[model samples]
Target: MSETILPELPQELWRAGKLELAHGVQQFLQVMRVASAGLGQYLAEIESRGVKDLYGYGTTISWFADIAGLSMGEARPYVNRAIDLNPTRALDGTEIPPFAPATGAAAAEGAIGAERIKQILEILRQIPAEVSVEDREHAEAKLAGLARDAGPRQVSDLGEQVLGWLDPDGKEPKDPEPAQPRRELTLQRRKDGYWNLKGLLDDEAGARTAAALEAYAKPRPVDEFGQADLRTKAERQGDAWVDLVDLAIACPDQPGTNGYRTLVHVTIGLEELKTGLGTACLDFVGTMTAREARLAACDCLMLPVVLNAAGEPLDVGRLRRFVTPGQRRALNIRDRGCTFPGCHRRPKNCHAHHIHHWADGGPTDLRNLTLLCSFHHRLIHHGDWQVRMAADGLPEFIPPQYLDPLQRTRRNTLI
Candidate 1:
């Protein structure tokens, strides 16, 4: 390992690092960029050749992506660029500015020297064990500037200088920015047969949603709570719905395009899960009647109410469903929204999914559904993933048969 350079302290006596430092940092950066570009180039070449093979003539783009760790969307473009840059055989049998046009490698072509593309690879072989992939690329981009001046001797010196600065013993990085917001919940069943729950949202939604749930869950006083009548299930539910609507309107929502809020989901238990071996199914709250329940059992993420052997309400807490306002809120929340995983769907990009579908016995409760950008929902409905409520009354997923024989399950605990 070499040494780290300190910015000149005018009063301090000069050290010998001055010459070695700048040149070293510069050298390491250049060598790495060439290599990464080369890998990209190599993959491109293989794909071009592979696609034309008779046995794979009609191979789907996705099939190629699965092998390359790229999304089909990305693989297609990468392949195109590689074919255009085709840099495999220079007279000296090395890369000849293969990606110059697309990547500005021409100006850099002359900037790097001595380390011929072939020589650069040899130097890269001696790259320090601790030199990271990023370091390699950063050095490579800078090295592009050296395309006309550097030689193997400089690469060795550069390695020492870089390893000194990057992995300077015990000089760890500052805390990094959090990738996703912190959100989580715990649902525990008490001996009393009721669930005690707690959750955390990014900001006020956490408190607001919790308070709203608490209000609905509060014990009633001789049926004096709001406009509900326990004697009639419809009246009681109607009252509950009014409370839900009132809460949705008054709560702070980031608004949506269609004059409403984003949809919320309240996934209840599912029937297929209860069966264990058949296809998955869901039941939305708006149609929780037997007929609706029966139909919803055909889709994914729709929550079917769970009943005991004697068929009594289990107090498993209802899910929020989307009403028009909720939909507005949903659209607002997901302005550039699609709920399909990794989808970038906007308002024009989605369909409001019934956490419980209308065909199934689901309610129009905000907790009963979630908004899914179309592609993902279709994937859910027709692909390998099966989403349903778990024993805990939240959404869980079972991967399709094609993904694994072990049946890996996933959970989307965010409500």
Candidate 2:
């Protein structure tokens, strides 16, 4: 190869007029196109002579990266261009044609750059293999002519139009294969005492799970204390999953429950059960705070095994702490839905919450119970809201001190 000299820029070019500066930029781009074509040809020569083996590199790209200080990503396009534009010699010494001869010629003369050549190659490659050699050559020549006057983006759009004209119906569609069964679940305990759940489900099971979660994941209403449901979408979905578990445990037809609706057993000391400040064993797998045990025990979703200080089982309370079905039907009919001031839940979604807790000797009758959804039920237990039965045998809510200094009573009329 002969060494080429670069032309010196005029000293006044820095302060040149707008037209002069624009013309200088166009000349620089033309020089860059010629350099790019030379680089591609050199790469082709290096590959033909197996120069990569002398350098102890596996491929031409690795060798180019080390020699030119370019990353593999930057060197790959040059190598690809070389493979498309350079002719090869067969074993018998006959010359084989390059993939894109017209593009190669234009690039060598500084008439087009790598991007334009790449766009032309992409369009030509998309021609169906079933297409004849004559038809493919015709399409390639037409695209290369368009490239001379149009940008890569315009050329790409024109290629799509040409392909549509060539094959109006597009490629033939194949029949879909049968779906395989797929269902998996992983429940692993973490060091922090929380269970990590992961799973995959088939289409039918996924759709059913999504529908179930969405049915219970509706946004919660603002409470009597003027506090809105600020939980995020993921948080609401998690709460919905808990509600679904509760529903499944309460189902009468589920197998392996031994005619008992509860799924697990929670054992706690009598002092802990009363004070709600200690730890309790949960199904021999982990421990939960006594307060959570109390809440779980409230609905009797898990059977509670009360132990005295001596670690012997003791009768904590009546076996029937949960409201009876007959009593629940009466409560549902009376409250209609959640009795929170702005809640809109239906009767089926409501729980029979105790005005006075059953553990505190409150009766499981109509006068001591009102229906509340899961969110409002927790709010009543944890937030600064209050609930009571009025003289008309209906439930009403009272605002917290921060929200209503006067603490006026309110009722939900939306339900």
TM-score of each: 0.22, 0.62
Q: Candidate 1, TM-score vs. the true structure? A: 0.22
Q: Write the per-residue lDDT of candidate 1 for residues 317-387, one digit (tens) a residue.
A: 44323356544565436333444333333443244555555544676544455555434565565566666
Candidate 2 residue runs with Cα over 4 Å from true position: 1-54, 59-128, 131-177, 201-218, 221-226, 247-252, 257-262, 315-320, 325-330
Error of 2 at 231 (Å): 2.4
Q: Give one digit per residue, the lDDT tens place, for model 2 in 1-415.
A: 2233344466987688897778777777777877877888888777766664567788888899878899999888889798788775555656668898888877876778888898888877777787887877777777877887888778888899878867777867674775566999999999899889999999899999999999999777665456678889999999899878766755657677532335557788878877777899888778988877766555554567889889998863336566666776787788888888888987666677878776567777898888887777877877888999899988888888888899999999887
Clash pairs for candidate 2: none
What TM value does model 2 have? 0.62
Top lDDT hit:
2
Q: Give the C-alpha lDDT of model 1.
A: 0.46
Error of 2 at 147 (Å): 16
